[model samples]
Target: MLLGSMARRVLANAEGERRAPRFVFVIQSNGFDAVQACPESIPFQKYADREKFEQLDLTQHKLPKGLAALEPLKGKTTIVQGLSGRSTGGGHSTHGGCLGLYRTSPASRSAHNATIDYELGRAAPGILPWIGVGMSAGQGDALMHYTARAPHKSMPIILSPEKAYNAYFSVAAGGDREKDFHLKRNLLDYMIGDVKKTRRALGSLGGEELDAYLSAYDELAARQYRLLANKDTLGKSAPKLDDRFTSDVATKRL
Candidate 1:
């Protein structure tokens, strides 16, 4: 969610006024049947001819049953196939390696070195770099997934839509901006002092790491202050809340 928005923002900023390309990745837990998604108008045997590349004009052909819902978006929709994921270890799940393009196993430590999403997020920084949302079946409040942040670091997905909404959009919702700014300012001041105290107690190497962390917090605080200063502008673009945000059904929340 965050990645998509950031990408959109990047595209908007690139061309001064022209619309930019946007990307969205809709990943499902269970695998999807590729055959079912293929257009019936295209001969399946054509795929067997590895000697030649084939392209189909989907605009002239009826969409596959699985993709019928996208009929309205035919002009913008694209169907790409024949990509291989053989290099990624396959099981019930690929864990972090799915996006990282590395072999990651449950038993292995430091398996996921890096992921494409995080790399992209780093390249295009936003108010919220990345937002991961998921729905678990019978997990009972436990948000377990194979996503990763960095090597040996598993990223946590927000399972609850309400929580996700609050995390990302709360600032844009109507509120007393002055009060919020003061509260955040006080909190950041306290955190800076605490980080300094902790750094003083640490050794040289640890202190250096703490210094970096503290600097990051300082940068974040500055960004937050700037955002709060422009609360009126942001609030105009805030998303409207509805029942789906608080729905218990995973699909509704998603």
Candidate 2:
């Protein structure tokens, strides 16, 4: 009876599982020379006393079959490479290799948003949103997924597995959608007054300008209405994160 009650409670609270879960993952970027996860490929492991200058012909670890299994989802997943913040302020950290992504390091920046996931997940005219997951929660440092300097806000990284699981419901089902409807209604209401005012203002300026402005307004309104009707078709589906894939990405294995 206790088990049944617990299961019932969990189900009741499971936020609507509306669609496929979207996952965003951030990890400490690695260098090409990084050792593979396979034990056999570890060059540092064999060294009893290592000299800084010593060159080790190390073997590389290969990801297991479970990872290769994801080849089926290749089209769904777009592996983007070679992007960075426009500038790093020339700080020594600026000289940073792939490790530079975290913004601040040792563990690296947690929540800076520029890295692909958050951008992709953003709610827009037509797109699936994003959820950032932290795969690089090293003990010494903080974990955040989205990181942007200054004006850009940092997106908190999903740390706990439960947090990640719950977020799946949030993004998948389109969290607080009712609120969005209310908000859109309010926005349209607000636009009604401003739009009329703009028309009047344009008339005062000149007949030609008034006609052009109204025409532009009509075009804009049409675009907004189109977006409203076809919201689902507007964006790419958020990436479905498989556990095996996450494991492969972590530890520089991917």
Instruction: Identify the leading candidate in terms of TM-score.
Output: 1
Candidate number of the best lDDT? 1
Deviation in angstroms for 253 in model 1? 2.9
Worst 10 residues of 1 by lDDT: 17-26
Q: For residues 95-209, what per-residue lDDT tens digits would candidate 1 score against the true structure? A: 5666778775667734457577766665664544455777877765435335555565555667776666554455666466345556767798789888988887775757557
- On the 0 to 100 scale, the lDDT of residue 196 in model 1 is 80
What local distance difference test score does each model get? 0.65, 0.42
Cα RMSD for candidates in order = 6.0, 15.8
Model 2: runs farther than 4 Å from truth?
Answer: 1-67, 74-113, 123-128, 136-142, 145-152, 170-254
| Per-residue alpha-carbon lDDT of candidate 2 for residues 134-202, written as tens digits (9 for 90 to 100) | 554462223432342212344455554444543333223255643454455457656665766877776
Q: In model 1, which regions exceed 4 Å deviation?
A: 1-15, 18-21, 43-51, 65-69, 109-111, 125-127, 140-149, 175-189, 205-234
- Candidate 2 similarity to native, TM-score: 0.31
Give the lowest summed-lDDT range of ten residues in model 2. 31-40
